[model samples]
Target: MSLENELKSLIIAELKLVDIKAEDINDDQPLFGEGLGLDSLDAVELVVLLQRHYKIETKDLEQSKEVFASVRSLANYIRAQQDRK
Candidate 1:
């Protein structure tokens, strides 16, 4: 599957999101607020998820904000980080 798909699945599973499937996630949809309804704690879990799954360490809070913007954004960030290695 595409990285975005993978990340979507990861997000759903990690967060134990009920009534949602990976396909339900829109690539450009916000993961917080009105989109996925994730909160600050969810953001922290997402950062840890990235590190655990992709070896990506988002140490900067502001940077995390951008990186976690959406599935597409997170997928792009992960791909870019992997490319740098």
Candidate 2:
């Protein structure tokens, strides 16, 4: 599966997001606020999800904002991090 799809699945599963599926998410959809209804706690969970699954560490607050923007962005960040290795 594609990384975006994978991330969507992980996000739903890891975050325990009920009534949602990978196909239900849009690539460009916002992950927080009105889009996916995620809050700050979910953001922390996302950080742990990325680290546990992708071995990624998002320490910068500003960078985390961009990285956690959407599934597509998260996938891109993971790819970029992997490419660096």
Put down candidate 1 lDDT per residue, 1-85, tens digits, no spaces.
Answer: 9999999999999999999999989999999999999998899899899889999999887888898999999999999999999
Worst 10 residues of 2 by lDDT: 6-15
C-alpha lDDT of candidate 2 relative to the true structure: 0.94
Model 2 residue 59 lDDT score: 100
Task: Give model 2's TM-score versus the native structure.
Answer: 0.97
What does the lDDT read for residue 30 in candidate 1?
99
What would the C-alpha RMSD of candidate 2 be, to one decimal place?
0.6
TM-score of each: 0.97, 0.97
Error of 2 at 77 (Å): 0.4
Give the Cα error of residue 39 in candidate 1, in Å: 0.6
Model 2, C-alpha of 72: deviation from truth (Å):
0.5
**Model 2 lDDT per residue over 1-85, tens place:** 9999889988998889999889999999999999999999999999999899989999999999999999989999999999999
